[model samples]
Target: MGGVIGLDVGGANTKAVWRNGGERRAVSRPFEVWRDREALAAVLREVVAGVAPEPVEAVALTTTAELSDAFRTKREGVGFVLDAAEAALGGPPLFAFTTAGEVVPFAEVRARAPEVAAANWLASALAVAAVHPDALMIDVGSTTADVVPIAAGRVAATGRTDLDRLLAGELVYTGALRTNLAAIAPRVPVRDSSCPVASELFAISADVQLILGHLAPGAYTCATPDGRPATVEFARERVARLVCADAEQMAAEEIDAIAAFLHAEQVRQVEAAVRRVSGRFEVAPPVVPLGAGAFLAREAAEQLGRAVAELPW
Candidate 1:
């Protein structure tokens, strides 16, 4: 088989996977489309080139970046992304994956653009279904967690669109790197007292994970809230600000304990969504964890006593 490229263009990142017969490769780059929509075509070309040295024979695309605030409407976002892909890939047989779990021609995608907007989760779930038959796909990325069920080798999701998925508990708006600490919990235990979290973006989940040694400094790719470094010392300082205090006001062990608390809180949030999504099935399915926050998925799975099938990505 010739080289076939699959792209998942997200709001904060662009990921590409190249499959050529027995060889397969993948690449992900931080390309916040809302920050610069004009650069998308260039970014796509760069990602494609990085994944596959040779020219690609065909292209399959899925996107959640359309929901980015860069565009006024979803239709406009869809059209812009489609145009960018065409510009980047030239004349390859282009296909778009829809929320319905089917790959349609680019012409169909343009005609029914709403069906394909933010459908990368469905595409990923379908891909996992083809291999596992019966499993739960949990993709915890930088900003969100997608809990999709795959039953009998098919995508068995309760909702299609982002809004619907959020309502159905299939989409949790918290992730590893970019999620705000305030969103994780309203109050966190500090020493002997429970302090209310400051309602500010002073720190993110990345800081919490970094302070707890869950993530390395280099692994925290998202920008810090205070525009500071992502090192452990800096992360501790960031977490201290969550309680409206500076690093000097708190001891190192106190900040570390807070980080541990927030990490467990985030895990609880994901575990709750997993239970809601998996409750629909008669028998519990093994969790297929994907993305950079696979550790969170594993923690949630262990809490539920479910088996884990780690994705090869």
Candidate 2:
């Protein structure tokens, strides 16, 4: 038996796992977007060295970044990924994943509909089924949480990936890294009266992750809309600062209030998701949670009155 490689290219970081004779061996450094193509390729080469010096027979790539219109306009982002893939595998069969559950050939991905659910949370959920077989996998990654139902080792697909799908409980958009608290809750208790949240910061569901401990400092990717690293303290400061735009700012009470508000809203969303799948699967489907934001996922499951079987990383 030869070796194989699995590469998950995300918006914030790139992860690679090398497997020799079906046994996992080594991994790579979390490649930040600040690094150039040459640097990323070097990192990949380093990760795959001991397992396979040259290209393997196949390379399965699940890219959440390259498919976004945000990345398409940049031009260099997807191209750089292709460059890295070719450099590593000598261009062997490259499979691009999508929320639709179809493994698209590289040529099709490079030419059309890249902006669709290419490597959406649904795709990650599918990846989980290959191992768990009959468990519901909830992947709460940097930007979204995907709750997928798996039975008989196949991931169920909804054929939809729009924001409405997420709101309707067909998908879970609440993530660890990039969701606005305002979106989570419009009215938050500030002082004696409820104050409407002001939309200003690029803060995401990650704020909830930070408070919940699903994510740590280094786990979060840098790249604030202004293009800087986001420190935990920085996130806290910005969140705290948002409180000041109103009369509630004087007491320094709005920060905690907002955190509490966001946390509750996240719980609401998770409960709604479990309800959506309740008709099809068990009221308790042996939840298998994975991702950078597993801690929050666990809490979300509890909100639905279920227990989680968290995978060991």
Candidate 3:
């Protein structure tokens, strides 16, 4: 059952996908690199070990974890990630996927760490573009959203780095889960009146999604903002706290309304990013939604009158 393994080491989570013939298995581990940067190697070993039916042929790695604040510089972070992978999977051949679509061997990654840094979107876009020549791919993950455009069988991205991508509308900081509620909907409607939200991490987008039924309890994989259980009722309580209220003080329906509004705001964020990125193309292409916030991407694509290409990745 050994074929290949693909791993994404993100700022908030580490995900691995093992593809061997017809069997595909995935493993996801919540790992806040900023909390304990050195522990990443252990996490890498754990996730791969959990998902591997047997030792895979080779390991392909992409990273946005390099953008985490744990390291003083991106170079350090990239080197650290490479080091972790080397330490964890010394037996497996390690390769790094770059923004330019180069499969760099681990020996070369350190010399070209800058290009290997935060190139997860390109890795995904290139994989999708292999099938769909011209399309707009929206990947709304837990902490960020990527709007990648592929044209004529080439990766047609306007920006290569995170900073440049943000400016080019290829990256939207708002995501489905981990994002703070205060960053998006600064104000909320309550009791037929508008209320200013507390500029705090009282709630996150995951709570809104849970209450809005966009995500189920099991799908809320990360830890809650308040460290409470991930349940619809608890999500409602978290959403209520955004407006300086609680479950007992606010009606459940009102909380639901708040969740709906927050959900719309997040959808609006991705939609706006998609619009901006699509403007770079001569003719806007259809959409391909990916990641945890795919529902939000689909909503945005529908609003833009673009047909979604349902591809099994």
Candidate 4:
């Protein structure tokens, strides 16, 4: 069989993996065009054009694009997918956003990969089951963490119910990017006062990750509502913008204090996520961590008191 391309289109980035004649390479680009499908498709076309002289073989795609409440219905979401697929592949790429138990055509595999309703951890489970057959699969990404209970080669679905599903210890809303530190915790201990961090329109989880060296500064983008690329100075400004008050007038100590506050909150959220899953599963957790944010995974493992196994991505 000829090598194919696997694209995982996430909320903050578009990840592309190419298997060209047994050689594998991966690229992740900023998903700044996520809010606008047309622009995203144009970029995808450029990426595809750069890869091959002609259309390669079949293309595979997985997406979290539809999850945005912006599109009210699945039909609209599907339409958006089809549009992008047509732009990149010269036709619709098979979609695979799905749930467990339901079998989909090979063409639809990406879109039909078990969803949160059945077990959002399906992708992580599949990725982990290849190696760790009998362990809790903790797939930590930039925006969320998913811990799935795996036994043998199958993923144990707690049920199809969303509420009960959360009780299964398979979903955590902490990722390597795009999360809000303010959402992680309200008060973070600084040099002095327990600074109560306010949820400003700035300071995404990516900034915290960048400061901790989990993500490179070059990865930062100004893909805010303004659509400009975020510079290092701009990121600092955004990070500073998270304060309840004006950041322009804040002292250097206050800026450091805010960073300290966010760092503390980040750790706390990881700890809370670990505890939430460990208590429910009642089994020794398996830390099968992947994603660009490596530091966060290690910290999460340390806080959770679990063995860490890095995926060879």
Candidate 5:
């Protein structure tokens, strides 16, 4: 193929990587499909154009947006997304990369929608296998982390569907952003005694990461839980509110402590799942991190005593 545009269309964010000969460029855009299902076509066009101003030979896709509750069922969501891709990417032939590693035409994929839905992990794992051969690949996105096990230069994942992946330690439904802090840490340490978090969406992983300095103002892509600025000060305020305290009331050290604890908890969650998945192999492979939250994956991989393999591609 002359130029290939690869897309991982997610519910909250759509990521595209355009590879033309030896040059590769990528772009990410936020698009909540559940809010405006029809806007996907426009997003697809814009995302593609952002990566490649000129037309490409093919559009390859791995979609997780089909899991959005906007559709009654995953089957329906897959068909809708495929339709949008076909319509928006008018001339290029559309191909859907399935969890089984086959690239089927968009038209045929509608019939295999169930298998094609939410196959981003498998797609990534397959790509990793082509490069690293044997690796424990983990992609920590905004709302989820995928732990895929590859062995012998093949996709050795035990799970295919999202449900199966969740059960097989191949999926941890928590990430470096957008995840409710309460879900990761029900209780955080306070100055004097441990305190239970307020069971509200006052803060998210983004806040914890921002407050802890893992994320910058510009990289905090998701909307803050409190609709405030993405600054460290605002992040501190949101994280403090997790314990139902204002930033002024809580010492900066205390808030910092809580953010650190929550960040560790997030890493612990992924690390546990990575251990479970990597342990399945006779010899665990190096960890390859992808996505915006690669920092979190690196932290988790280090805790597991695994090398963080670099992807030259």
Candidate 6:
């Protein structure tokens, strides 16, 4: 056997890992599947090519992209993604991990499409659980955050689906990027005064993180809200618009303050979810932070006074 490539195709990004003879390489690319579903095959091909020059022996697939608004139904989304993966990988032995924790063949996934939809979090959590017996997996991606509990070397998650995860406080919609500022808070402080935020898509979390120096211009893979450059200057300009104001109208320090406030609010939101999941375990477990926004996870863990374990990505 050559090696197995694991893929987690998401709505806003595509993540892949190539494992061969104990050597592994992982890569994530910005690919808005909803905006350009037809380009998925090309994106997949590019991602695979980045990690492995030769043909992969097999591919294990998982996805949250099927939940994108591009498809009318999840069945259609699953079929489309499977087709693209097949075409991109040249029909290598393919498998899809399901919410039931089963890796079924591509052919079997059609009948179990719902189970396979948005199950990437489960796959990640299970993989972590296999190594750490008692821990909380905090995966904060660009568009969402997952808080999954692992107890006794098993997945102690309460939710099997995204909806259920949301209800169970295991899934938080906030992330390191792409989240609307309006969703984070209705208003922000501006020099001792609270200013109402515009409900429009004026700014996203990426802009906030960019201005706060948490992310670099190149690290922001998602499209900017104003279709402007991802530079710190432009990001500051976007954050200024959250209050329906421009950079000229606000001082640089004022804009930075707003970004700092929003960043704290986001951390609070993720912390709430982390606390909810942590309550399930008898004793506090070490938090294993994963994904791009691992800093948020580490901060949340520190706030909860728990030990931290960084996931080797």
State TM-scores per candidate. 0.96, 0.75, 0.96, 0.78, 0.97, 0.97
Lowest lDDT block of 10, candidate 3:
304-313
User: Which numbered prediction scores highest in lDDT against the true structure?
Assistant: 1
Give the CA lDDT, 0 to 100, for residue 233 in model 5: 89
Worst 10 residues of 6 by lDDT: 304-313
Model 4: CA > 4 A from native: 20-22, 49-55, 91-97, 101-103, 106-121, 157-169, 189-191, 221-236, 245-253, 280-282
lDDT of 3 by residue, 1-313 (tens): 6789999999999999998877788898889999998899999999999889577799999998988899888899999999999999988799999988899899977899999988999988987898899999899999789999999989889899899999999999988889999998778889899889999899999999988788989999999998999999998888888888999999999999888888888888888998888887789888989999989999999887889996775
Candidate 5 regions exceeding 4 Å error are none
Candidate 2 structure quality by residue, lDDT tens digits, 1-313: 3566667766556677666664675453455544454566666556556455666666667655553444444235666665676576555587666556677666676654443333555656665777777777777666577777778778764535455456556567676666766677777776788777667664566654564455676666534543444555455555554444533344334565666677777767766786676566654567787776666668777776676775544
lDDT of 4 by residue, 17-133 (tens): 667664776776776544675676766666555544355565656556555554565456545654676656764234343555342434554353334122334655775787877
In candidate 2, position 22 carries an lDDT of 41
Candidate 1 lDDT, 1-313, residue by residue in tens: 4689999899999999998876899999998999999999999999998998677788999999989999998889999999999999886799999888789989877989889899999888888987899999999999899999999998889899999999999999989999999988999998788999999899999898888777888889878998988998988899999999888899999999999998998889899999899878899989999888888999999999999986655
Q: Which whole-number lDDT from 0 to 100 does residue 91 have in model 3?
A: 83
What is the lDDT, from 0 to 100, of the residue 85 in candidate 4? Answer: 62
Clash pairs (backbone) in predicted model 1: none
Each model's C-alpha lDDT? 0.90, 0.62, 0.90, 0.59, 0.89, 0.89
Better of 3 and 5 by TM-score: 5
Clashes of each: 0, 4, 0, 19, 0, 0
Worst 10 residues of 1 by lDDT: 304-313
Please identify model 3 stretches exceeding 4 Å from their true place.
21-23
Task: Give the alpha carbon lDDT tens digit for every residue of 149-262 in model 5.
Answer: 888898888888888889999999888789998888778999778899998999889888888889887889988887889998888898888888997899989999999998
lDDT winner between 3 and 4, please give it: 3
